[model samples]
Target: MFWKKFNLNKQYNILYLDYNATTPIDPRVLDAMLPFLKENFANPSSTHYFGSNINESVKTARIQVANLIGADETEIIFTSGSTEAINIAIKGVAENYINKGKHIITVSTEHKAVLDTCKYLETKGYEITYLPVQKNGLINLNELNKSLRSDTILVSVMYVNNETGVIQPIKEISALTHEIGALFMADATQAVGKIEIDVDDFGIDILCLSGHKMYAPKGIGALYVKKGIRLPAYTHGGGHENGLRSGTLNVPSIVALGKACEIAEQEMQQDAERIVSLRNELENELLKIPETFVNGSIENRIYNVSNICFKGCDANVMIGRMKNVAVSNGSACTSAVIEPSHVLAAMGLSDDYAFASLRFSLGKFNTKEEIKSVVEILKTELEFMNS
Candidate 1:
């Protein structure tokens, strides 16, 4: 949609609802990053004193990231993104510090980062239990408890369902996980900046987040591993990111992320009220069409996300008709294929409904007028499709 303002001649102005996939960088965030990219270019790992000055920006970002999750700065380790942070969280913990225990537990509805990582670990002789999702894409606490055994080393669950906007019962899960002395890991990529979180109060041992998700630049994110936890390192280089992830620290993106976090900390409450209201208005208007239903009936779903399933219209057809609405099929990372989203299938949706699901994600810039017009367009298109 950002591209549309420049090309105003295009008919049917576009709307973006794919915030679950990614969000546009807030202008303030971009402004904060400008100096690091252009003038203050410096490697945070450099030995020279001048370039090393960039570490201040990186440290500030670290505090910002820490603030969002209620984590300590020492607990945060910078990485390329959520995918990399997830890899470090799981593999680093599993491989470097292998115990006699080889059992791990993760939900079937987990992001590809968790599921795919578990699958790869399977080849390495580790046993994993893929927990099933309820019809609403939430895992059963009893089932999770039943799966945990004496040999369980880790339990990874996402804090929020990316496709359905379902928020998991993290406190309950974390409490149960720690009771058995197993580590609890959370892929907080979808929850951070949009919801409230606290690392210590929630009993989280490991957590992953993406800077891009919070209005910062992509190619940078952070992993939080609680202090006193001896997880193994994934990256081996000149020792960056506490030697957990080895790379020259991304100074520019790091600075941007810190600034984004600062803004998120200050504006989270207001943003939640506004974004949630916008999404609700959107759902109310669009649901006026016959045979369209919300997939997950979560009362406490993320404020910016609304997953709607139009019974007959194909996702591709809907997308074609919707125009510049930068929304998604289910998940943006997995939209490259013709597959009916695995997430919807896991949530027990039939192919017809799953294929019809569209994710509209809101951001700091989305307006109510834009949402209203989007619904009007959908109403017209649905009528045409039915005709």
Candidate 2:
């Protein structure tokens, strides 16, 4: 009923199930953003009256974002997106803490932003240990414990896997990293709005999230750096975001992200209840199809995602044929790459099964009717493909 007030035009009669890739901006978020985009526009860093007022709005937004994740408002640093935040967190630590160590530990299944950033660090003589995951898509704690070393500066892990929705053992990982005197970071882009997160409770020294992943507009995100942690400046301009990230603040999108975070804090429990039920119904029915299996640890995943391996079905072809049904085979970032998902491959899936997998990610806007329609469409498409 709440979603009914929002006009989801369902462009081209499509049923969208790709929330992990990005979410449609909530009408409430847009409403909060419009004022900044038009008459209220002012440089938050300026001393002028209008700019002073706009700066207050940005401060409120910072509090809103921090409140959602149980962080102090001062801990939040605005960035362009998760990629930028990840880069700042990883690269900044490497730069500032180079005297202490040059080694970092991250998982093999991390998003390209983290993986590629670590790869780049390798050229600078940093030692990166990419921990492998089990078939259920969870990192082994023992392996992580053994991997921790005196030279390890940071341990970066994602809170949830974008494709399979696999929730990682962040608290345990953080504990292990701390034992070796290393800071812990989490890319919570896919986890922040979808689940509860407390930076202090989880021992997260640094965390990053993208607004677009949580029903806010694109080009806005935040990095949470714990108190007493100092990261090197990411940009060199009029010092913004506590001199960590610089340049003009994106006031409109920041307001939108704040509103989205507020809304998510209020509605996450109910949203999870409804969406998980729909996800279970869809997953159960789809699993009835022959040779289908779920990917990742079903018991340890987020409520909205179901990555299913449909043996013998080419996921790319299946997606292409479903003209009005929007889903994905893997991360949208790597969609252009011809290779199968490195995540699935790291979890020991053969190329065939990896290519056969499809990710169905539900969102608050999706309805039971839409789920049924999607299931029917997939069944029909699979039958035709088999024939």
The alpha-carbon RMSD values of the candidates against the true structure, listed in the order shown, are 2.7, 1.0
The residue-by-residue lDDT of candidate 2 on 190-295, one tens digit each, is: 9998899999999999999999999999999999999999888889887788898879999999999999999999999999999999999999999999999999
lDDT of each: 0.84, 0.94
Worst 10 residues of 2 by lDDT: 4-13
**Residue 69, candidate 2: alpha-carbon lDDT:** 99
Predicted candidate 1 versus true structure: per-residue lDDT over 118-138, tens digit per residue: 999999999999998888788
Q: Give candidate 1's total backbone clashes.
A: 6
Worst 10 residues of 1 by lDDT: 1-10
